[model samples]
Target: MSEQHTYRVIVRGVWDGLSEDSRARLLAEVDDHGLTAMTFSEEGSLTYDRALKHFSWRFTVVSDAADGDEMAAAIAEDRAASALAALGHGFRDLRSTVTDLDTMKINYKGGRR
Candidate 1:
């Protein structure tokens, strides 16, 4: 049987100067990317120390049998990139993590050691 996998996209640094329209644009971008589920926190709630603060927007992308094996990974990646691009300012950086079904651990730049 084919193996299962999970993909996640974490977006940070949504500039405080962003306008209401821009925020909406970002949400649309996430949806356009084809993520399984997406959610954003209210603005002004996130702090520098805790970037994932109450205000920060967190989007979690899941790739499983429901997404169909042929196109889950590609869709997730595309969505992540698009969402990052939408944050014109206060957009610090975008981090992506992937994991296998058998091993729920992530393999990042650290070499998965």
Candidate 2:
């Protein structure tokens, strides 16, 4: 079995509403939470200007499935969820949709699940 996993986390909100300092604090908190990798995607300015402006942040946590048990995936997911929640950013648990060997992908959004 392969030994790789991926997870996605979506954060929706006015990215611009957050001050630069707050942004930095959020990023630092994420890092402190120990996520393997994280990426952010922002809609175009026009969309950002819309009433429902929002942004998405994805987190990918890599682990070795072949060397570990299913618990690893659960732990990763729990940790990610806790981390985001700790940052005061809404964190919705989207459970793992894909559970391939060495790969587990979980999705999370800030708003309602």
Candidate 3:
């Protein structure tokens, strides 16, 4: 059985400035990738560090990823980046954990891009 991947995405940009249509387009792109969009609060002052619009997403996806089959990972990463770029937003970090079907264990991993 293949593993399931849960991706935590932090997208930062000017969300308040975007037009309604732009917002819809952005969510639509997210939906296209089978990811149901979620919301994120400002969490601090308007002038908080860097002061960019931010949203957090959580979605689970499964791919036929073998030990070294990078195509699945690469495709998933590209699709996510494209979804963000379509709305003129910046793609930050994507933290994911792989759950082995047999072992049923969750491990946290990291990578910055």
lDDT of all predictions: 0.41, 0.41, 0.40
Listed in order, each prediction's TM-score against the native is: 0.30, 0.30, 0.35
Residue-level lDDT for 53 in candidate 2: 30
Candidate 3 per-residue lDDT over residues 39-92, each given as its tens digit: 222221111122234543332334544542244334445555565566565446
Model 3 / residue 95 / CA error / Å: 3.6
Clashes of each: 4, 1, 0
Say which prediction, candidate 1 or candidate 3, comes out ahead on TM-score: 3
Score residue 5 of candidate 1 by CA lDDT: 54
**Candidate 2: minimum summed lDDT over ten consecutive residues — where?**
41-50
Local error of candidate 2 at 110, Å? Answer: 42
Q: Please, what are the lDDT tens digits per residue for candidate 2 over residues 24-62?
A: 665655443233333322210111222223433333445
Model 3 reaches what TM-score against the true structure? 0.35
